[model samples]
Target: MENKGNSESTTTTTTTTSTAPSTESIGVAKDGCNSSRILNINVGIMGHVDSGKTSLAKVLSTSLSTAALDKSPASQERGITLDLGFSSFNVDVASHPLLSQRSEIANHYDRVQFTLVDCPGHASLIRTIIGGSQIIDMMFLVIDINKGIQTQTAEIDQIPQESRQSKIDTMSTKLRKVLEKTCFSQSPMVSVSANPGVVSEEANVNNNQQQQQQQPLQPSQPIGLNQMIDELCKFIEIPKRDDQGTFLFEFDHCFQIKGQGSVLTGTVLKGSIEINQTVQIPQLNLEKKIKSMQMFHKPVKKVVQGDRAGICVTQLDSKLLERGLLCTPKTVPLLNGAIISIEKVRFYKNLVKTNSHFHVTIGHTTTTAIVTFFGNKILDQSTPTTKEETGSIHQFNEKIEYSFMEYLEPTSLEYPVGSQFALIKFDHPVLCPLESVIIGSKLDVALDTSGCRIAFHGSLLQGIDASNRQILHDTLRIFKTKVKEGAVERVHSEDTLIGKNLFSKQTDLSSFIGNYLFGILLVSLSPLDYYLNLLLKRVDKKTFL
Candidate 1:
């Protein structure tokens, strides 16, 4: 895991090891000088299992001279990325003397650093993949060129339709159908074989180090690897970060590094944390002081927003601080928001109903959230500046609400995310960013049903307590009373008038019928006594005659 840095060019290293690859060589190389600042953008590689996302990430890292970050023991054993892996490389196309004179490249593409995030592609590890995707600026979807797209691309409708002539009509061209309601809906894609024969010499393989092991792979050049890198560098736009907001950091991995004590490695999500600064671990409910900090493997006084770095902290067990933990300033209070209201929710199919459950991914963490409310939500619509973003205390306007008739029913599938919003309530409290909620449904449910699997995605505007539901109901009633009072009054008056007229027109005929029926069927009055007298009289008369 050795990486070298130079004043002129960036260098990367690669090898098979137990430790994660350190991107020490990527920083100063990006700027080509000590004074300039390099822009760092996070990119994630995502696709179905065995789509070669890990290999592609390694190839990109090798091309850039930074060590590839794929050192999971289980992943090495299984030959697949089972967890989130990170690799970074500098791409300063304009830094080269030949391109520096060009206005376009110098103005925009100069000194850009990319943190390549390689996420696991297994369907079972979808949550991990989601966790990876949440942090990245954009996604690079990898698909097997030979296989085209796999089953997870779309829920192939086995139910025969009039449009399809055969029972097994799987059009690979229609794989794009799954994109409409996904977080990666409009993402860029690359196609390669699961075991692409072209493995660059620099791009080392896991090797046949286990049972039935084979010889190490020959150092062959990747076919489309360079072209992919060029396109990525050109396509990926710089992401805006909160350097002035709350001092927040989302650590994906934390472990003891022998002499380093406890090292937490992750990209800085917002604001800045200086050396010796104490940061609060929301999940642990404790504040720990930063003993030391390093960015790009170099010691720094402070780590600013959007930079990837590792920090050694005091008074904390590294094992306990894994992915999904947030380190923020003690001044910022952790929000207890279980009920999140979402807007701009885009669903693939079917109207999202209240009380329905869907998977929610927020900042490299995934969980289930129940649909608490749905409808056209009216919010303040005011964007938050950096100063107001930290430990945000949202004072929602009392008039703001999901108007009555906001529910999305089966009959109203026309309304989508932006047109209508949803209020999702998670099972437990979540620390979601200002706007980072992604919602999607599992495809298994649609296997027997008709339509797409993705449900909806939206950001958390604000949260509400379940206890406030009665107040909302009362407000809705008041609004309805004011808006449609005349219509309601007319219907009530008409109903009362009709009831009075019907009762007045009818007469009582029960007494006469009861008297008549009693004379005929009374056993003690006529039928039983007449039969007994007739039997005795007939027998006596016959004998007398």
Candidate 2:
């Protein structure tokens, strides 16, 4: 009986223990994690007329329609990207070895990921260039293989340089003010029994000296963010070396509807935007919600960097949003007046076209300004040109010029225009700083050694497409001469160029594109890449003229 009772008691105890959950038990867990963090980076392509800015972007973006089949008849007929187009392409972070590491991807993801913003190269759309530039992460800085650097190129490059420098200066000033206060408070102190003022002065000087000695020689080190910014700002002529997080792009077109509300179209330069995300109109300080987005007439849940999508906004009218007005995120940094350093600025036609004043096109808007020589004295107010004048003052009706250049995003503010840079201040606040530039002819300014070399080589190999073997053959010849050292040859061996088959020599392309398409075809029969590859192969097989 005792043995039977023990067995029953043990079984009951075991059952109770198994049935009851432990106090430490958390719950069933999930394997995968979802992230709210997003990288929004904007890229812009600027080049002189017929430089293939549109062609380059068309091939890069996954969303935008190609030039041959684009909906607007004007775009197809004119062979130009009318207005502005926005598009997004996915970049695999793992494919790039540098970005594969956890720490690097976490830190330098924006620089590595590619998103392109396409802008019109015509001189008339300077306003659009400025406005569009505000949201970009880096610039492609495209030059037509044929046209080395033109007047438009100088103007385009100048705007971003000026805008970036201005922002750095503004941030630096703020930081310096903060540092001055901290430095004053942190200085060593001395107390004297008699003659307090005398002792204080002497002590203060000594304390300052001691403090200076204790401080690091490199001011680049941050006592705090403000102090670092202040030190950074002191380099008035240089571009700050810093990385910007988040993506933004500015739109050039705005239209209103009776029932549909306000709509705008352009590329997003920096950060991703979601439906219902509050968007700010910087020019007017008005905010609106992103009601809906349409990319190639299809709806998407969210739009991020490099996306060319049309946004329908709530609670805003077309009248409030104009051509030059900035369409940006509600919470982004406000870029304003810039004191920019410029490098290359040219004349409208030739270097000596005194009578020909050039129009500066930034973003989708254009402004008329007088062309003045680089070294000429800038008049404080608007002045008229003369027949025999060497330099002329060009003024716009509104203060749009200044604002466009200074409103560049913080990441890409490089040095000024000339080797001996010039400092220029815009008349008003530009909503988009990155896109603003000083417009002049391409021949006026002297090119830097590196820039000259690039120009010379590019000039030699104009009209050479990457797909053409003849172009590659010519490029190989130029490469041999320009790159004197044997080092370039080794680098060239590893260098991979994009192929015409869309199957660029990249492993990712072969794997993701080729293999993935094959797998999908087993189930679906037709995929975009499969058809594209088939078409490219057929084109390659054909005989040329």
Per-residue lDDT tens digits for candidate 2, residues 310-366, read 788866868766454334544433332222223332112222232233333344443
Error of 1 at 218 (Å): 4.0
For every candidate in turn, the CA RMSD to the true structure comes to: 17.9, 33.5
Give the TM-scores of the predictions, in the order they appear.
Answer: 0.64, 0.36
Stretch of 10 with least lDDT, candidate 1: 2-11
Runs of candidate 1 exceeding 4 Å displacement = 1-36, 62-69, 95-110, 152-219, 330-347, 377-397, 404-419, 438-453, 465-545
Clashing pairs in 1: 11-65, 12-65, 12-66, 345-417
